[model samples]
Target: MVTERLPAKISEKSEEKKIAPASPIGIFDSGVGGLTVLAEIMRQLPNEDVIYIADSARVPYGGRPPEEIIKINQELIPYLIDQGVKLIIMACGTSSSIAYPVLKDKYKVHIIGLIEPGVRAALSATRSGTIGVIATAGTIHSQAYQKTLQSMKKTGLPAGREIKIAAEACPLFVPLIEGGFIETEETRKVAKEYLKPLLKEEIDTLILGCTHYPHLVKVLNALTGGKVVLVDPAEEAVAEAKGLLQKAGTMKGKTFPPRYEYLVTGSVAQFQDVGSRLLGKLITHARQARLPTPERSDGGQVHLPLK
Candidate 1:
């Protein structure tokens, strides 16, 4: 059996060296989309603290330029780091694509993105050679999924085989989810139209490349007729985070599920309303936060408003 080596510069660490038990695992997305990843991480790594930030003020980074996305990420990420987070999870697919290479090597803590894990899950689940990916406009336009799939094909994994990758941008997905329309007929119609190509292509597996898409899981499932497998990238991302934390010995003994902290850059009430719909649970409060200005080249900073 061949063993895959951990990426260079990442290694085992002693858990006792940590300064505080309350250190959080910082997660950020363009808006409430990240809650999907937060849900999975809370489920899988029950003992850690999660600090989730929703940049609702600048929601839907899709269709924006990569440089703009990078600026947003640079600002959001550094703020999370300043909050003393042990690890940073880039839950936004667009930001992950634009900033991961530039930011990952610079951060002292571990950085995990949604793309590679999503690709891995898609590759693993596909019995047929073709895979379908549905994401935001920015993510699809970035071609991150295609690039990852191509890299996976080149890497020669065990039982190596080439896989065909297809991607589509579902621009309406986030709006539908945030508008509390996931269960509505309108959402179903959109899902059907957006998914038609993949269905026609006879793709056996589909990657739900956008974090917000998971909130519409049932709608998508219904449209796909339970035949095509849908892969939630956030779920796979959390699994990867658990593995990394475990291997690094950062996992504390399981006592109880981690407490979740939600922060939003825009309306708190909207976050609660939309977050409750996405999370399938009521969110009483979302602490206010100020994201950095994109103009700042130093990766703008974030400030939490006094409660």
Candidate 2:
């Protein structure tokens, strides 16, 4: 998939500049997990303003139907646009897999997804030729990671070796982490069961395909015996965003105020609570915002909502 980075939409006034570096980069995810991506952006692109939206009211997008994932994004995109985001990041794997294709071509603003970055990172890191992917059912079913790897393998890598991939849908991981189940026996048990097939595949590298999976690292490492490398797409995704901004000469670069904005479609209290934990700091402000209920292209309303 092509991850395009463009200038935010400009006012139609002919005299107006086409680009604005001061516009915040927008990021949206099903819940707190995308904070992993946001944390990396803060660390790597400190100068740029960032706005994050947590669709926490309907948090777990994993098992939902593809159309429903796109439906939720219908609510997300316009909110970010109203926030004056120059670029939007689909930090949720489920949305990236299902909604991205729908939005990338349709939206005028730049949109980037988490899948290709994770795939590329895993490809670059794996030496044993075997890689395992753990993600939401929607992501796995969509085969975004699988397709990425397959495309790379089809052309062959510099090493000229075939790559092996094992994809598993850890549908429960997102909810467990959202519920604060990390580092517990409950988590470990779940990890073992979910990772069993991949372990048997003898994969040397694992892609933490869901952003939420990063917090479950301790359990994942224990389950994988710490020998398998874990690829977190957060870093790679941010790296790509940074590079794009650099090429645009859009780095905020000490000239602007710290404009880290946070919004949610869920309870502000819960959003702040889980987001603060993932972000490793006190998230002082989070406001709830209502989104439009999605409708069909034919002008009918979409009635599905998943948690």
Top-scoring candidate (TM-score): 2
User: In model 2, what lDDT does residue 304 have?
Assistant: 39
Give the whole-model CA lDDT for all candidates, comma-separated.
0.76, 0.79
Q: RMSD for all candidates, in order, please.
A: 8.7, 6.4
Q: How do the residues 104-153 of candidate 2 rate in per-residue lDDT, one tens digit apiece?
A: 87666678898888888888888878999999988999998898888876
TM-score of 2: 0.87
Off by over 4 Å in 2: 1-18, 154-156, 293-307
